[model samples]
Target: MIKFLSALIFSLLIPLSASAAEYSDGNGYTTIKTPVRTSDPNKIEVTEIFWYGCPHCYSLEPLVQAWKKDLPSDVDFKYLPAVFGRGWLAHAKAFYVADLLGMEDKIRADLFNAIHVERRNLNSEDALARFFADYGVNEDDFRKQYDSFAVNSRLSQADAKIRAYGARGVPGIIVNGKYLVSAESANGNENIFKVVDFLIEQERQK
Candidate 1:
């Protein structure tokens, strides 16, 4: 159910067309008309909004991980699950649930591999519970947290941010809440960080 729904939403809404790699405004990156304020006014925030079921996102995951490894002390990095539909909403909720349980980092890579590599059907609650059980999280406890207020509240916040971003695709990168980058804008998945580095410096100089 979720798999089909998410794919439908993704295909219908996201424009995957590649743009010129001018490495400048409107080419490699786009300026958000209305900048969404960053969570921290002091640090430069780089947020990557993605979906687990997105192949492009999964491909870029390794690059994202490598890029963020040596982030400067003044820069803050975050990940927000993209919510395009109920299917996405379920994944978003699961993200927060994993965070709340202190298993986000541990489960992040495996979850992606489960869907993309292992080809597992993790589109349902029971499926996710079974997956979590491998990490020692009981099925009932996992479900309880999956439906908890904390996760839902985080989902609401993410949904609002997604709307604010006007994002039409996954593996979207937002720099300081002012500039947006994606494979479409950045020419390709590999060049995303190049444009992001430019934007980060651009913000730093301001």
Candidate 2:
């Protein structure tokens, strides 16, 4: 059910388009050593490796949301919380728990807002529980699932994938698992999507 709902939400995130002009090498992204292939050959997978506590990710949130509004239908975007830093795994768990509870889309921006804008301390389980409860999510239920096997499994998979992408920092974007782009490479938040769109076009032609 989780995967199905996630797919449905992804399918509706953006628009549709075809190929584009050539993309120069080393402009804004790096090709992965072993490209991570997508499950659906018909869809180009775009994954963002981010941590909620990351200020850069927070700043890029609005731009990414705006960019996603018009994403080509053949592109599928999903968030992969980077758990490389201290206390990051806990936050990753929160993300999965939110998804499990069907509140990911509802609270994703709010989580970023709470931490960056509202200055809420959601670093720990107790703190996050209270934060989620404010949204009417059952505290007990959230806590239970937060530590469940399913969430843990997803976190484990995320750890492996982040390492595979060779992302030394947060807020990395991987297009079709073949290219990696970040603020440093893209030069700015807004341009990251431009690089992604270019990569998606590159993949579409294949």
Candidate 3:
């Protein structure tokens, strides 16, 4: 009778253990040492490291936007374009130029479509100039900001932050400088924000 009672208790405990296993510390995300300093002390900074040329980053854009709409007021979302090596600095420049011209929101996803959907080679200054011209920005204006000291300063800052964040690839999500979540760690783009939400809550407690 004691053995029979023990078997029943073990079976009951099995389901509880399995359910608790869903949320794990290391399986879905990795913690970083020395949490990166956030610009706003009042808000939790969530940075999405991406490249405009990357299809995966393009695909995740809409989903991320939808998720952004419902984010808690304490969470701040920002983008940091990944500059892995040579040739990527051009798109990084495009990001800042759009910001300087106050057209970042208008051109961000459109640039992605131009690259992956429209199949345009926008990795060059001439091509980017033409692309910006279509949005009513003249070549001189676009080029001026593209090479301006302020824009270059922002690029340098992004480069340093990317290195310090230890980003491995495009579409990496860093939460409050403490956790790094990517498609590889989260299993797919769909779950990246879910892990991000988890990390936000984790930071809130600290």
Compare the candidates by TM-score and give the number of the best one: 3
Clashing pairs in 2: 15-73
TM-score of each: 0.87, 0.87, 0.89
- lDDT score, candidate 1, position 132: 92
Task: Return the clash pairs for model 1, or none.
Answer: none
Local error of candidate 3 at 193, Å? 0.9
- Score candidate 1 by TM-score against the native: 0.87
Best by lDDT: 3
Worst 10 residues of 3 by lDDT: 19-28
Task: Give the alpha carbon lDDT tens digit for every residue of 120-173 in model 1.
Answer: 988778888999999999999999999988888888888788778878779899
- Model 2's TM-score against the true structure: 0.87
* Order of candidate numbers by TM-score, starting with the best: 3, 1, 2
RMSD of 2: 12.6
Off by over 4 Å in 2: 1-23
